[model samples]
Target: MTLLWIITALWAVSFSLIGVYISGQVDDTIAVTTRMFLALLIFLPFWRPAPWRKSLRMMATGAVEIGLTYLFLYQSYHYLSVPELLLFTIFTPLYVSLFSDLLARRWPRQFWAPALLAVAGAAVIRWTDLSGDYWIGFAFIQAANACFAFGQVWYRQQSMGNPLPHRARFAWFFLGAFIIAGSAMLLTADWSKLPATPVQQGVLLWLGVVTSGLGYLGWSYGSTKVSAQQLAVMNNMLIPAGILVNVLFWGGHIEQWPRLLLGCACLAAALWLCRKRTPAPSRST
Candidate 1:
């Protein structure tokens, strides 16, 4: 959970950086590929070949979670407006709950309640007028959300019985992610849009090294320390955090302060409801 909070705080800055720097200046495919490649480099030296099966599963997790999630996300911008993309992502917590339920073959209402509340909280912060266009983008964003949710649930469940340290074998995770993003870059990247300015290159370097590299690793490892409900709640924490960061640093305005506060209150309540009196680590990762 500490890791989750740290990553969330760092990623708040990352979102703004992408919006201000890399979104239009660089080819999306190239940017994604570079981030994955750099992240892979971070953990590549730690990869041990002795645990081939575990490495394969880790690769599969990365491929679905960050790899396909980002791919679908970027592609969706072509079909949907930015507001639509943001709005659609609010349901990610719901997917986290649903996927966890499906994987366990049991639907617990208690788990679903907090997840829905998190969704409501995120929706409150993000709700706005819809353009009624780009319905296709809705599907794309949902796919992205499900990929992320499923990956978190899958990793948390599997990591319980695995005795290896997460850092020891995390390289394969980024290798699979790089494979997916690199393939997309090869197929669709526009070479002319590659970073033309020092600032753009610097931003990519920071995002790849710090944001994507450490952020993803921290988020995945942290998921192992909490319950599914807590993970679901944490998934929506980024909304208010991002908004606060934007308002403070980027001169963003709140259209409705009361609405934002109310949404945050809902999120806080949801998190509290999921809290346990005696906290236990799911397993020592």
Candidate 2:
């Protein structure tokens, strides 16, 4: 399980590079479509869906929850630095916690203490040397997180007992992603100006196969094996992990050690909360 986390962190970093690599070749729509198409190719052979039997609700859910959200996020790479774009992701757990509270009809008393701590830590990160685009990118990142947080909750609620296995779920998601992202590409991307260099093509291929297909597969597999709260905690680490990787390989720079320390402290607190045992529901005496 720990190994899974390490693997995911490494992939998380690598995926950022893939995003930068493709920024020049394809528009967000095509890159997303290419990713989905590759993932679908890997999944479709494994899980065959009856052409007409796939439900409209399932299709729409996949499109909104996964496809469109990813489209916006991949586009963020073009407009924002890796570190700046990742900071926006700090809002995911906050939004998820809020949504969970609303849907459960009960606030998460356990989360509030650590949540505040996490926000304070993120604020520390912000105090470091700021870029002009950071503020603007923050807005887009928040929008992306809103979509992801809402979609994740809705998908989990609606699909908890869904008969489709993980592979099948991936298939459906990719199918819908292909439809939605393909349409967006047709409208937004200039097909004539596609990249011709081997390095560019290699990057796109890796993005599609490794990051889009295998990364999602690994994440879904790990999700099934872990609790949701644990997953949330692990997600927070993505920011630090992403930044560290970019700094080492892609010339990513951080101005202050305080930001790093604060972020790590916040992640530690979240993970601690996630690891706490929950009491079982009791019947009325």
Candidate 3:
């Protein structure tokens, strides 16, 4: 749980950095491909041989979660403003709760309240007037949300019983992401929009190494420690955290501090509620 919170803070800054330094300037496919390859290299040295089936599963998870999710998310920017995208992500907590419950073949009714509360909290933080290709953009964001939610739940439920440590096996995950993202980059990336400034390169490097590499590693491991309800609510923590990051570092405006505070209070109440419930351990653990 501590680890998840730490990475959540780290990723909060990542949202602003990517928007400011990479979003429009760098090709989305190339950016994602570079980040995956760099993250793959980070875990490569720790890699140990594992059963083919287990490696393949990890790779598949990465492909859907990181690779496909990024593809949908980046493309959505073409049709939706950042505020609209953030607003759409409010559905992800529900997806996480539903998918995690489905994968377990049992529904914990207690899980839904906190998850929905988190959604309400996020909606408060990012709610705004919408415009421009509403249905198309909503569909793209939902696809990304579903992929991300499914990946997290699926990975948390996998049981390989392999001897290798998770860190050692994580290379396969990034390798899978690399296969998808790299292929996409090769097919569609605009070489003309590659990062030109040192600031852009540095930002990409930080994103790849710290944000993608360490961030995903921490998040995956952290998911193993908490209940499904906790995980679901935690997904919404990013909304307030990212907004705070922008307000602090990116000169972004926050028009309604009272609403922001109310939203954060709701998130806190949800987290507390989840913590008080008895944690139902996943079978894989």
- Ten-residue segment with the worst summed lDDT in candidate 1? 276-285
Candidate order by lDDT, highest to lowest?
3, 1, 2
Candidates' lDDT values, in order?
A: 0.74, 0.65, 0.78
TM-score-sorted candidate list, best first: 3, 1, 2
What is the Å distance of residue 145 in model 2 from its true position?
2.1
Instruction: Please give, for residues 1-285, the per-residue lDDT of candidate 3 as tens digits.
Output: 999999989988887787778887899999899899899999999988877888898899999988898888877776665544665665676667667656767554686787678667756754664344655776788899899988888888773355666688679889999999999999999999998999999998998899989999899889877876678767877877887677777887756778767876776666566545624535443
TM-scores of the candidates in the order shown: 0.79, 0.75, 0.81
Candidate 3: C-alpha lDDT = 0.78
Best by lDDT: 3
Could you tell me which residue pairs clash in candidate 3?
A: none
User: What TM-score quantifies how close candidate 1 is to the native fold?
Assistant: 0.79
Candidate 1 lDDT, tens digit per residue, 1-285? 888999989977876677667776788888888888888899877877747787788888888898898878776766553433554565677667667766776543565566678657756754673233444666687799899998888888778777767775468778888998889999989999998899999999999899988888899888887887778778877766766666678775566777767776775666555443213223221
Candidate achieving the largest TM-score? 3
Superposing every Cα of model 3 onto the true structure, what RMSD results? 4.2
Residue 199 displacement in candidate 2 (angstroms): 1.5
